[model samples]
Target: MFVNKAYRFRLYPNKKQEVLIAKTIGCSRFVFNRFLSLWNESYQTTGKGLSFNFCSSQLTQLKKELEWLKEVDSHALQSSLKNLADSFDRYFKKQNEAPRFKNKRNNVQSYTTNIEKKNQNPEVSIAENRLKLPKLGWIRFANCREVKGRILNATIRKSPSGRYFVSLLVETEVKEIPKTASTVGIDVGLKDFAILSNGKVYKNPKFFRALEEKLAKAQRILSRRQRLAIQQKRPLSEAKNVQKQRIKVARIHEQVVHARTNYLQKISTEIIKNHDIIGIEDLQVSNMIKNRKLAKAISEVSWSEFRTMLEYKAKWYGRQVIAVDPRHTSQKCHSCGHTAKENRQTQAAFICVSCGHSENADINASRNIHELAILL
Candidate 1:
């Protein structure tokens, strides 16, 4: 079956390429913001925003008038306009909040450019450790895996920790695996990352908490540097010591993110490969986070990220993932269908008052989720 997928890799650009990339990112952001302003002005004055075609046509004039804009990839500029248009469309549909202007200080820089298909030349290709883009030419990247199929577009981004990455969107086909009879349910928690219906538990790595002390120390040093800079009447951005400490703090957070992502990817792949049908709670994480007491633990566990990984991996592996209602999964007795506050004897134990049944709380929840999935 055909599947649209994205593969991301770290980029190692030379000094000249880095300059060009920075220019391209800046120009893309400028074009997007400028057009957004025009769109708003037109909407207020004429009750309608500029059409995509109209915006593109104006961009041609803009590039001609602004010589610096001509130095970057023209396709990237156009893509910026398309992104703004798409964002506004989503806003109108109430699917997302309105788009905001991109700020350089935000510490996240990115631009998207599409690969053109021509009769004589392919727009994108990979050779060894190099990747060819529209205007950037061959740039070195860590080729962790071979990219297959037609390349549609790519988004290049620079993180706060001064790392560059490129996400390549590709159109490819994947063969579905043979059906398996095995099925399982999962209950996610803070003590353990996940508890399976079959009584297996995946321990929470707690990456952030593990690095919290180091992070706090780095931040404290950064704060001291900032205070010194302020006393000297200089902007924090211009303070050398402050900048160095900021990077130190950022790297710690980056490590945490990488560790969590790696763990989720590994566990999700294992679950998808082992089971044909996977059931999980349909957790309202946003509402759940409102409870300030549990928010930190919830965020650290990264349940949303885990669920997202499971869903996408399930599709790729030819497995089924079902979201069961979370209402009484923890409180309900799996053996007798009795559900009440008294059923949960403690955080870790469940003893059904009506049926006198006993089980691990998380395991019981997983069993209830499994039954719900089977019914669904």
Candidate 2:
């Protein structure tokens, strides 16, 4: 099976190289926005959309027109154009969703270059790490993870902190493990993200809560400087301060994201390894958030991220995951198959009205999930 994996590489460049990196990232964003504008215009006027190749040719024409465009390397420019075209292709494939206009935001985009076809191996030496592009010269990145499979593409990016990193996508074959005999079910909640059927309760790390105060402080500082800058007719000092504030906020956000991602990775790896078939409740986050009492706690969680982790890790481990309707997972008595609204009293205890069976509320729900999975 082909798996999508990302490997990060650290970059150390001189002042001149840093400028080039900034320009390259900016140029790529410009190209993406320019192409998006053309695409929407074409759709509005001719009622016929352009293909990836056609959009790419337009970018090449525009590149030739700009004097400073020559400063960026040629291959990099072409790669940027290609990446934009691919973005459109993927967007249009999900035509039901409305495509948003590309903004000049930091994440507006980074740059991508095909690595697998050009480089025989990712473990290439630093001397060979240099990648040539349209206006950019040979840029090199030291090896990190062993490029076990052919690299599909590598993206070059300048993070909000003004740091640069490259993310690599590789294609490789993995053997599926023989079927395992164990199965498990998990019930997720606000306090503990999940409670397993075997009476194991996993607490919710609440990644967002840990960073909430810091983010709030950063936002306040950002707003103060932003307001002053607007009032002062865009003072350079204010502009610089605002940029600093934005980076501070972005750093905290990134840390929280990494922590959450790490937690989910650990949980998913455990779930996939020991279980052949896993069952979980299909939670409607939006609907569940209506409870004003728990909204603060609910907002801190990333249940959807957890679900995604389970899905991909399960695939990696040659296991399967099934999400069943969450209708009575909490109220239903696993022992007697009795579901009653009154069975749940407070947040901790579940007492079956019909069977008089009592259990820890979340644990009972998880047990019910396991029971339902075994039935299937």
TM-score each candidate.
Answer: 0.97, 0.86
Over 4 Å off in model 1, which ranges? none
- Assess each prediction's global lDDT (C-alpha) against the native: 0.92, 0.75
Q: Write the per-residue lDDT of candidate 1 for residues 248-319, one digit (tens) a residue.
A: 998999999999999999999888888999999999899999999999999888899999999987888789
TM-score quality measure for candidate 1: 0.97
lDDT of 2 by residue, 1-376 (tens): 8777777775666678878777776676676667777878898999966677887677668867986776765556667666656666777788445445545564524677654445344432234555443234456666554666656666777776666777767677766777769888998888888888877777888888878998999999999989988988996454988988888988888788779888888888887887898899888888877999987777667788888889987887689898888898898998899888999986998888898998799989888888777777
